[model samples]
Target: MTVRSDDTTLEITRVFDAPPARVFAAWLDLGQFQSWIGPEGIDCEVELLEPRVGGRYRLVMNTPERVIPVSGVFRSIEPCRRLVFTWGWEGDAIRQSLITLTFREIGGKTELTLRQEGLGSVESRDGHVRGWNSALNKLDHYLSGGARR
Candidate 1:
């Protein structure tokens, strides 16, 4: 996406204890999503949120010596089944990526799948894969009542 002409894709899968509706709600709610948007050590703060399609959302991830800004516009919202949004990391994700998240119910548990596309290079793709894995793992713990301190 960035200024580059090429595009890449990244995908990851994880399971959450909650139901699809609940998980979707967490994503839809600014406060809840902020509580679990980043890696274990990174703190997230919500700035602006509009969850419907064609809406905008913004958040900041604070870490050592840096504040990462993330902004997105929702492209699709399918209740408990799917969500599609454009993701930009203030200065980085600008490389161009549209992220899609799909939630499915399996035996009362929710399976979450993240698909990111339109990245321009391998480095950006790798960074997103790592970032998504960390975020999703943190979310898994959060949903399981980790009592994170």
Candidate 2:
């Protein structure tokens, strides 16, 4: 309904060594996704990703400690510019929360702005903030090591 309807917002910023095109492809392609993405120290298996507007995908993360599942539906896809999607964890009753990622080029680098909104509560939003911070840091390393589509 409203941005951060629970009155909390999760925003994370990270710059990647790759261009926006390559970074975007890493999110769209399953093989590249499996290679990089997910919380630190967790393994991810993508069940599906349609990669087009209105397409949806489900991914399973099998951590040695626990398993987490997330599904997302693409809302917008502007090549090398922006992407918006609805994301929901498997066991959550509230679904269809939004995540918007914007890619801006600065001095031959891609600056990513990740914002996940509509968290139901302060706890949910806070948890996601920390999680995304970790995840994006990994993305930084992944790209730093020359990861590409």
Candidate 3:
């Protein structure tokens, strides 16, 4: 995976050894999402999920030390191609951010690009960078047939 970031935005590009539809499904499918959505050692529970545009979703991520609650509203969804959403922690001081995901087919594999904008600060963006990279790494393992964490 490749990562790029600025004070207010983060972008990640990763290629998965799976078809575009499969990769896209991982994001919208509850079982698949719960199986591989968090960083190593973090357990994630989907509190609610409504994948259609204008729908809402919520998650509770548990780590050894803390519980993080996040929720979002879908802005757009295009099967096997793209998704756009609003993301924010349930009670955080930070403002809500927009995330866009693009999927491209390449030689039977999928190239996924995730872009997050409107982070409140560089520190917030960096934290998301770390979290997302770790989560994506776990996703890679999941796609390669590893057992869920």
Candidate 4:
């Protein structure tokens, strides 16, 4: 996996051994999503998940320091291909961002590209870089049939 960040945006690219459909399903399926969507050692709870466009979802991430609630609305969804969503913290609704995921099939594997924009600051973008990289590492392990934490 490779992660890159700029002033207000972050991009991550990862190759998974699973097929595109399986990899894409992991993002929308609550059971699958909760298994691999947060930084290492963080416990995640999916409060609500509505996978269709215009639908909303909420998640609570319990880190060692504190619990963070994140909510989002699905903007677009194309099965096994792409997904776009609006992301924001529950308390700070004004600081909303956009996340786009693209899935491409290569041989029998899948190439996943994640792009998050409008982070508002370099520090925030960097934080996401670390968080996302760690999350993707977990995703890789999960797809490899490793036990979920």
lDDT of each structure? 0.81, 0.79, 0.92, 0.92
- Clash number for candidate 1: 4
Question: On a 0 to 100 scale, what is the lDDT of residue 148 in model 3?
Answer: 89
Error of 1 at 34 (Å): 1.5
| Regions more than 4 Å wrong, model 3 | none
For model 4, the superposed segments whose C-alpha errors exceed 4 Å read: none
Per-residue lDDT, model 4, residue 35, is: 84
Model 2's alpha-carbon lDDT is: 0.79
Per-candidate RMSD vs. true structure?
4.6, 4.1, 1.0, 0.9
User: Which stretches of candidate 1 lie above 4 Å from their native place?
Assistant: 1-7, 91-94
TM-score of each: 0.88, 0.87, 0.96, 0.96
Compute the lDDT of residue 73 as modeled in candidate 4.
97
lDDT, model 3, position 89:
88
Q: Flag clash pairs in model 4.
A: none
CA lDDT for candidate 1: 0.81
- The weakest ten consecutive residues by lDDT in model 2 span 1-10
Report the lDDT tens digits of candidate 2 across residue range 37-139: 6777677778898999999999898878889899988999999999999989898858447999999897888888888888888888877876676667666
